[model samples]
Target: MEITAKVPETSLKIKQKAIVIGGSIAGLLIARVLTDYFDQVTIVERDRFPDEPQPRSGVPQSHQLHVLLTQGYRTLNQLFPGLEEELASWDVYTLNWTADLKWLLPGGWSPHFPSELKTQSCSRNLLEFLIRKRLAAYSNLEFKETTIVTGLLLNPNRTAVEGVKLRHSNGTETQLTAQFIVDASGRNSQTPQWLKSLGYEPPQETIVNAFLGYSTRWYEYAGNEPLDYKALYLMPRAPHQSRGGVLYRVEGNRWIIGLIGVGKDYPPTDEVGFLEFARSLRNSEVYEAIKNAQPISPIYGYRRTENRLRHYEGLSRFPNNFVVVGDAVCVFNPVYGQGMTVAGLAALLLDQCFKQHTKSNSNPDLKNLGKQFQKKLALANKVPWLMATGEDLRWFTTEGEQPSVMTRFLQWYIEQVIFLASDQAEVYQAFMEVIHMTKPSTVFFRPSILLSVMRRMLSRHHKS
Candidate 1:
């Protein structure tokens, strides 16, 4: 591990070393920010990372596809500029959400609107590989692979983390001392239970489940195969079956198809059934596109689609010097693809904390960092949660989150706005801006947006 100094803004010695558990994207980003305050940062992982761009044992969710949103890509590019170039070198596709690609929001199929917003995508393996390579060059950022974190080592007061106990691959045990510890271990993180053993209660949990499933296959686009895949979407109507699909170009000239469902409906993993599922969508373009293409892999399926959120920050006794990111804090419906974006927002919040502490006269609030970080982290979910969870509620016949009266009104209004926007440029752009995450949902409530909605409602074209 090689640690290099990029800048020296203050001579104030960093009294704290930091430890980050989890080698996933969330963990890596936390390590990136901790460099500003820690003399050294170590990442612990249970899976032995690959030497080349490949998959790991622990990150099974990576078997599916992942794309970095505008917010995530922007945050990462700012921290490690030139990353996109590096990813492109590995065949990652940089997609303009509106220009280079086609998208189907619940509102309607996305029109060819001029777009400044862009998202870069590739296989999860390639994305993580590039990030790992960048961080590996730093001597201060250490990687202890195939090691399991047994539990945290709390001080006598049991209020702050002093270090962590680890079990190596050979079954050897060791204590890793650190001034700050971040639990980026993801959805399966054990920090909550570990905290409970030390006399802390686990945080409250919120779940909005929509039993969704997807079957994916890697197809090499032969001649005439669409590289600029029109992003396809099919949202099921309420009191009826709700299903949707997404087909987009990923790295290595491969395309990924993610078909989602409400309740028990799902895309089949069998070869023939996969095709049937694609054809079952509202549009047949995706199904037709893959008809004669070569399939290099078997049809893959994953069904772990439940929205789980641990309100760790809401806990009355959140331990000092700890913060959780990624799936550990909140796991969203994969079909929505907000997990990576939300994780990026969490890392940016970490960056903000680092900047504030670096500029502060006193040491930043390490003990209260969890709480402060939670506040910022929660903001990341506010819009996405509303979007995905609220949408899920619409599919609820037997189970799902129950929407309030305001939610009911908003849903009806959103449907009209989206359908109307399908033809009205101003209405379409406003809805697009919010859906792509370029702007906040509050943008929908603006007086200008309201006028656009009203005018569209009054227009005859919209009625048609």
Candidate 2:
């Protein structure tokens, strides 16, 4: 499937131009969506994008493992048709969640069976490269590489954003005006400071840090041993278990192994300590699988795994014709693998908002669209925020806001669900769906699942 340049109907094209900050996955997807509503869309990236599929300086974590959840995969395919085929052509591994993943839960190993949750495994570099390549086909889309956004260009009243101030790599400064602007600049976004500089109050922020750290190393496939699963995950149980690991087969028949530690027990980057950390996981599968594999890259350590949400929607005053998306608005702990999927969902929501805005008004401008989109994006971000922070708060050493009574109750209930998932395929499938964002977390509260949880609790109670 090929995505052709979208020629928006004259009546629907409400904006003459739009600007997107950053050129990561979120920015790229947002720019793609903007092409439908704006005559021209430009992406300003701080780093000079590489010519091929390789790690760049801008995305420090690009070398780590990236899982494109089912919803993310579907959304990407919707945005850029034939994305899956293109990934397959690059030898990316495609596997069903349940059938191809060997997951070690807190209780035991989860049951493996065929299910609908199918997705691809690859390094972040490759995925971004393919998406950017697809995006290049649009004639109206433009990329300003090695350019940084200095600040927002606002109207005299400071109630609306007119464009952005740019600083090119050549030390030249210029301003690019647009009808609409979006900030998708990831976690290090300077939107808060920019707002402050404009004499506007920044959004309130909530931080939930588990102090989790991980080290990743790339490896070449060397073993001829047959395995039932293509990927392996050893999840850390809260309070006591602070170590975990994951081994995934990515493109080019290579494996990306990540060793995780919580509560400030940072994974070591040294050769000996990396393997030792893997050996400390709850299960030996990840360690056993990679102990003999030929390592191809040095161990890379990353520690910034906090879940942060800047409540932009709650702000009393926000500039019109401007909005925040992706990590700039809400960033999740990467351990949950929700970042990319949530960004994809945000882009889709932006598309829907544009359609609705154009359909309702005969001559629409981006007057109140930013506020509307921010509120809706906040609501959309709630579930994943809870999912990531809920898990992070389970650790006793976690900082920031403490869990509420409802959160504690849900955590306890979810632990039971995790136990049941080890043996019950139905429960596991539903759990996978919720985790993959295909269904709401409310699915766990449905009558059927609730009854199962009660029965399991009662059985365990009687046994105790």
**Maximum-lDDT candidate:** 2
Q: Please, what are the lDDT tens digits per residue for candidate 1 over residues 187-268? A: 8889778988988988878888878777777777665732445355555655465666676677777777666666878788
In lDDT terms, how accurate is model 2? 0.89
Residue 100 deviation, candidate 2, in Å? 0.4
Compose the digit string of candidate 2's lDDT tens values, residues 361-396: 767866889999999999999888988888898899
User: Which parts of model 2 have CA positions greater than 4 angstroms off?
Assistant: 1-12, 360-362
Cand. 1 TM to true fold: 0.92
- Model 2 TM-score, all chains together: 0.97
